[model samples]
Target: MCNHLAFWFGKDPARMDAMFRRSGLMREKWERDDYRAATIGKAIEGTPNVYDPNFGRRVGIRFGTNPGPGPGVTSGFSPPRSWDDPTRLAEDYLSGRCVRVVIDKCYLYRVDSDKPERNDCWEPVSDAWMQSDMWQLCVAAALQEWERKEAKRVADNEKAAQDAEENGEEAKQKKPEVVPPVFPAMVNSALLDTKSQSRLFDDTKLGTWIDGDPNAPHPVRVGNGLLDLKTRELKKHSPAWFSTTKIPAIYDPKEPYPVKVLDLLKYVFDGDDTRISVFQECLGACLSSKLIWKHFTAFEGDGDSGKSTLLNLILLFLGERNCSTISLKKLTTEKFAAFDMYGKAANLSADEAYFESADEGRLRELTGGDWVYWEEKFKSGFKGRNITKIFFSCNRMPKFSDKSNAIWNRLILFPCENVIPADKKDPIYMTPEFWEGSQSGLLNFALDGLDRYLSNRRITFSPKIVLAGERHRSASDSARMYLQDNFVEKDHARVATHLIYADYLDWLAVNGYKGQLESNMFGKEIPQLFKSAKSQTRDGVRCWIGITQTTSKEDLDFRRNIHPTNKERARQRENDSRGHTSYGQAYARLVEGNN
Candidate 1:
C-alpha cells in the first residue's frame, strides 16, 4: 500500500503518514514499519509559538517548526499592543504575575506532547550552562515578587501615617515585608491564574441568546469564527465572551470545490443532487454550535463503499483541533465519554455497530444540544453544552433496543450504496498530503452548504435517502418494522399474543435482525408505535386490540412488482412526517427490502 501511495506525495512513506497524522487520520498497525514513524511530526524538535491568554489571540505567533521569538529576546512582550505599554509588560514579567508566559514554543509545535513523569525533570537537560540559566530565571522571578511586595508595604505605611496625622492621631505600625514563595507556589496562590476574574477570556461568556430560553441557546460557531446567526456573518469581537477554539474551516467564495473530493462524493451518492446537497450541508453544519436542526449523521454501507473515503475527508475538513473521536457504545456507557467533546466542534466514531443503547438519554442529551453533566477522573462534575456534530458509519446497521420515534427523529441517513472494488480503491484518498492542496476548495464547498442551511435553517432529505434511512433505522428495531410490514390498524381486531410473537420471530430472523425481546417487553412497548393498540385476553388466550396481524404474502409480492419511479420517490418526500410511521397500507407501496 505504501509503495503505491506515490501520486504527488513523493516517495517518502513516513512523510506521507506524517501528513496523515497532522491531518488526524487514524490507521491500523498492519502496515510497514515506516508508518510508525508518522509520529515523527510530534518527536521532531520544534519551538511553540507564543500564546497570550490575556488577549485570547496569537501575538507575533510564527507557528510550525520554524523558530520565532524564543526566550533569548525576553526583554519585553513579543507583539506590543497599541494600548499596551511594553514597559508594563516587562514589569509584570518581573513581578512574576504578568499573566504572560510561553504557553507554546517562543515561536512552536502545538503543545500536544506526551506528559513527562514529572514537570520539573532534569533527565532532558544535563548541560551546566542551560541548567544555570534555568535556576537563575526561577530565582529572579521570586526576588522580583519579593521586592514588589516590600515596595507596596512601604507605600501603604506612608499613606497610613499621613491619614493618621491628618486626624491628629499617632501613626499606625508598619506591616512586615512579605516573603515570596517559589514560582510554582505563586501559581498555586492565584498569581497568573486563568481562573481569576481578571482574565480576558472565558467560556460561553458570549452568554445565552434567546430571551424566553425555551431550548438552551448554543452559541453557534461557523465558517471562521463564532457566527452571528442573525446577521449570517462572522461575529464581531466581544470582550465578555471568548471561544476557546475556532473551527479551522475558512469560507472563501472564490475557492472551487476540491476536484478529487467532489468526484468521490458525487460517485458515492450516485450523482443524486439531493443526497449530495444534504451531505455538503452536513459538512458545513459541523462548524457551528449545536443546532437542533443539525441532526446526527449516519453513513450506512458496507466496507467497500466510499464510507471511509468520505469519512476521512470530513475529518480533514473539520481539522484536528475541533474534532474528537468516541464511539456510540463509549458515548452511551463510558461516564466521561461526553466530556471528551468539551470544546470540540464534531465528535465522530470511525466504526460503530448498532446495539441496545445503555443510556439513550445521554445520546439524546448529546444530539439535542441540552446541557450535559460531564465528569472526569479526579475532577468535579462540569455541566455544559456544545454543538458538536455527531457522525458514525456502519456496514450493517445495529439492532437497537429503542422503541421510540425520538432517536429516529434525530438522524439524517446517507446511504453509501456505491461500492469501490478492492482492486479499484484509490490510495490517494487516504494519502495525508492530498488534502493540503484541496483545503481551500473543501472549505468553500462546505461553506456553500452552510449558506443554504443558514437561508432555510434546516436540511431536507431526498426521498431516496429517506427510504434508505428508514430501511436502516427500521432494521435496528425489527419489531417495529414487523409491525409496519405485517400489520394494519382496525377498529375491531384481536390477534393472539402467541401468534403475533411467533411470526415476529420468523420475520425478525428472515430480515437479518439480531436478538429478540421477551413477549412481556414486546407487549409492553407495542403501544408506543401504534397509538391505538392495546393488549387484552380473549378466549382465555392473550391478544392484542385495535390492530390486526396480517402475514399476507400478496402485499409483499405486490411491493416487489412496483418500482421506485420518480413520482413514487417524490411522493415519499411529500409528507415529511412520514418517517414516524408508515402504516401497512402505505407500507405495501413503500416497503423496503424483502419486507
Candidate 2:
C-alpha cells in the first residue's frame, strides 16, 4: 500500500510554508519529497508521530533544528490548541496572556491581534457569556482566587493600622458620617443620641442642663445621648445657654475667673459706686430673665469707657447665638423690627442713639410683655411676646415721645464714666479666646445672681442709683430744663404758656437737642415735669398758675440771687405775689436791709 501522507498533508505546500514563516518556525531548506520521506519513515518505525486508528494521526513538523508538531496536529510536542477551546481561551485571559479590554458594560473583548486597523482577531466576551452556566462556573473559580488575594491585602492594611495606633501614631482617617439638621424641639445635651430620640426635654422651658449621674435619667438629650443632670459632675460639661446652634458646655470649674467683677465695674462705672451697684442689679435681672421679666439696661458714656466690653461679656455669658443685634430705634420705629428679637435671650445695640423720636406705645409693649406684631419682607406678620432682654451702649441716651413714666420705669441706666487711657488699654481681653476661657467662671457668677434674684424677686439699687436715675430722667426731659430756667414757684404767680413754649424752643436750639415739639406738645409735656402745676387759658392767654415767668430783668435778678433757704424763698414768693418788683427798688431794699 502506497503511503497516502500527501492526502493528509493537503495539496497546499506553499500555504504550509507561509504559516511556518509567520510563526517564526521556518527551516533553512524544505522539499516536499524530503518531508514525505521523513513522514513515511516515522510511520513505518511506529514512532509517536505515527497514525493510530483510535486517536487519529500524531503529525510532527520540524522547524529548523527544533523539531515540533504544527498548530492543529495532535502531537505531544505541539503547543495546546487554546484558540479552538472556549474554556482554554477563558483560562488564557485569567492567566493574563490574553489582554482583556472592557468595551462597554454589556460587552468586553479579549484582544489577541496586535493590528490596530482590523478587529477580526478580537474575541467578544459578552455579559451573556459571564451569565451562562459554563462561563459562570469558570468565573466562580477565578473569583475564589481573586477573593483570597483581596483578603490578604485587607488583613495586611488592618495590621499596619493597628501597629501604627499602638506606637502612638495617627491612624488613617476614616470616612466621616453625615450629620442631620438640628431641630428646635430637640434636647441639646452632649450625651443624648440625636438620631434615635424623638424628644430631649419634657417641656420647652429654656435653662442650663449639666450632665449629672451616668445611671440617672437625663433631663436633656445631647447628640443621641441622655445627660443625667442630677448625678453627673457639673464641671465636666461646658457652660452653655439656649442658642440657635449647639455648643458644648465645657468649662474648667477649677480655673480662676480672669475678669474680676469689681475691676469690670470700676472700668465701666469709673469708681461710681452707685452705677456699679445698679449695673450689677441689671446684670442679675438680665441673667434671671424669667424672674426679672421686662427691665432693660442702658449704658451711656463717651467712647472707650468699656461699654462694648461690658456688653460683650454679658453676651458671651448668654452665648453668641442667644443674642441678636438691633438698634432700639428700629425696635420702636419699624413695624417688623421685633422679628430679629425672636429666639434671642438678649438684643444688643452698640450704635449711637440716632433716633430722636420713638413710639412710646411700642417701647412700653416690648417691656410690658405685650404681644409684639412683627413682619418680614414677603412673609405674613406674626405676633410674639418680647422675652428678650434689651441692652444698649450709646454716646447719647435714646429719646422717646412717650412722656408717661412707663418707659422710664423699665430702664436701668449704667453710666460708663471711665474712659480707658490709650497706653493702658488691653486689646487681648476682646479676643474670643479670653471670653471662651472665662465662660465657666462668668456662668457661675451669673447663676449666683440669678439665684439671688429668684429668691428676692427684686433687683435692689443703692440710694445713689436712685439719684442717678432721677438725673438721667431730668436730662432726657427737655421740658424739665424749660421748667427750671423759665419758671419760679409762687402761689399767685403765672407764666404765659406761649412764652414758655418759645423759651423751650430757644433752649432746644442752644443746647443742640435734635427735633422740635410743637407749642401744644410742649404745653402737654410741661405737666409731666411739674406735676403740681395746672394749665389754664385766662382771657385768651394760656397760663400755668404758681409758675411765674421771668418776664422782667428785676424778676430774673431776684430769681438768680435767691438761695435754697425757707425764709428768703418765702420773702421772694411774697414779693412776687404782691406784683412787679423793679430791679432798682429790689437793689435799694437789699442795700437798706443790710444798713
Candidate 3:
C-alpha cells in the first residue's frame, strides 16, 4: 500500500479564512505575494503544476532524494492505484510543495501527462508561487485610486474659494450705503415689492390714488429712497383764487383714461425700444431684453426746459413707487450696492449733477442692461427681475471728455425750447395732480399699445454707423444726429439738416457745377453705420459729410498724405487738336471761370 496525502492550500488562507470562514485562500497575503499569476490561469480549473506553478507545463517534483511517483507503480509516499477511488481522491494532499488554489468545488492538479489529479491523489504543502505580473496590477490599481482622490481634493478647494468670493460680494451688496438705520417721516413702514406694484397699481384711477389734492403728498418707499409725489406747492403767499376760476371736468365718461396711462407707464419702464432699434440698425449685435441699455438719454438745457419736468413726468407715468432715485453726489458703485439689496428696481434715475461721481463702468452696465452683483451668501437676490430704464438730466450735454460717444448715443436728446411764450404765462395749468392724472391715463394707453405692438412687432434698434471719407462725413453726421435723437429707421438727416444741404444744393446749381451733389448723400444718410463702425476713421468720414462733423486732426493728417492726384490730366495729349490756346493756359482759364 502507498501513503498519499493531499490538502487544500490557498492564498492567505490564515488571513482571509479568519475574516470569513470557508474562504480557503487568505487573499490578502496571497495577493501581497503576487500569487494571482499562479492563480488566474488555473483558478477556474483548480489545477496545480510541478515545474510551472501557473499550470501550463508539467514536470515531476523531487521530495528530498525521492523521485516523484509513477502512474502505474506504487511508491511509499505516493497514492496507490486506489487514486481512482472517490474516497482516496477526496482525501489526498500534496507532499511538500503547494501553490495557492481557488477551490470552486474540488481540488485538482496537472499530471505529467496533462491529466487532472484530484486532492486525494495529491500531496499539498505551502510554498511561494506568486507571479510578478499580479504585483504590477495591484500597484497600478492602487496608484489610480490615489490619483483620483487627489484630483477631487484639488477641484473641491478651487470651488470653495470661488464660492467664498461670491458670498463676500453678495454680502457687500446686501448692505448698500442708503439702507436706512432710522425711519424718515414720509417713508412707508413696509417696503413695496416691485413685482406686486405692477399688479396692485394695475388699476389706473390717478384721482382715486391721490385724491386730486393740489397740495397732497404721497410718499412711497423705493429700494433705497423715498419718492414724493406732490401736487402744486404754494411758493409764496397766495390768496384762494377768486372763486371765479373753477372749470368743469370735461372728460368723457365713456372713454376712460386708465388704459392709456397704464400702457404709457409700461413703456416708460419696460419698452425695449433701445434693444429693438439697436438690433434693427446693427446686424449681429447681441441684445438681451433683460440687459440694461448701455446708452444714456439726456434731456439737456436750462432749468425750465422740461429736463427736470420731463423726469417728473416720466415718473408720474411709471409710478412713483417703481423708480429709484440717486443723488448726483451719492451715485457710486458703493451706493448702487444698497440699491441692489432692496432687490432689483424698475427704473434708475440720477441728476446730471452726479455724473462726475459715478463709476463709468457701473453706469454703463446699468444703462446697458447688465445686472449688478449683490455679493454675499450663495443666493442671487435680484437678476433679470425688472424692465430697467435709466433717466439722466443735465443743464448741458455731457462734454465729450466726460463720456464716450457710445454713452452719448444712448440719450434721446429732447430739445425743449421755451414753449412759445404765450403758452407759458396763460395761468400755466398742469397742477402736479393734473399732470399726474394726465400721465396716469396717457401712460396706461402707451403700455397697452406696447403690449399689443410688442406681441406683433420685433423691437428694432439702430446700429452705430461707421463712415469712411472726410468728404462724405457731413452726410454721415446728419444721419447719426437723427438716429441719436429718434429711434426710428428712416434717414432723418436729410430732413434735419435739410436747410444746410439745401444751401449746398443751391450753391452747386448756381455755380454751374456738373458733379453729382447727391453722391455724398449715401454716407450722410447712414451716419449711424459709420458711428457703429469700430474704426473712428470710418465713422469720422461719414459724420463729416452728413453733419458738418470732421475727421480727427490726427486722421486728417494721415489721409491728407494719401489724397488723390489728378491722373486724368496726364492721359490727355499735350497737343490735342482744335484749341486756339496752349492746354495749360486753357486749363487755367477754365478754372478761373468756374471760381
Top TM-score prediction, candidate number: 1
What TM-score number comes out for model 3?
A: 0.30
lDDT of each: 0.56, 0.51, 0.32
Runs of candidate 1 exceeding 4 Å displacement: 1-184, 190-194, 197-241, 353-357, 454-457, 489-548, 552-595
Name the TM-score of candidate 2. Answer: 0.49
For every model shown, the clashing-pair count is: 8, 21, 99
**Model 2, span 410-471: residue lDDT tens:** 87777666789999888866766766556556544544555555566666665655565667
For each candidate, C-alpha RMSD in Å?
18.4, 29.1, 35.1
Q: RMSD to the native, candidate 3?
A: 35.1
Model 1 C-alpha lDDT per residue in residues 1-595, reported as the tens digit of each score: 2321222133445544533333223467624466465533333323122222332233222111212366767654475432122233233322321121121101011222243211111111222432232233334344444556667888998998999999999998666654443354333332222212222222222134311242433444433444454344554322122233344445454778878887887889888889989898888786555344436888888777888777788877766656788887888888887777765667778768767546877887777767767676565665667567888888866544566667777778888888887888778877768777677687667767877888886786588778876786666776777888777887767666665675565555445576787887777667876789888765455667787766675643343334333345334333422553333223333233113
lDDT of 3 by residue, 417-468 (tens): 3332434532232245646346323422333343333454433332221111
Q: List the residue pairs that clash in candidate 1.
A: 47-108, 48-105, 48-108, 49-108, 221-289, 289-387, 290-387, 354-398
> What residue runs in model 3 are displaced by over 4 Å at the alpha carbon?
1-296, 332-351, 354-358, 375-386, 400-409, 418-430, 436-440, 452-595
Cα displacement (Å) at residue 403, model 2: 2.2
In order of lDDT, best first, we have 1, 2, 3
Give the Å error, residue 347, model 1.
0.9
Every model's TM-score? 0.58, 0.49, 0.30
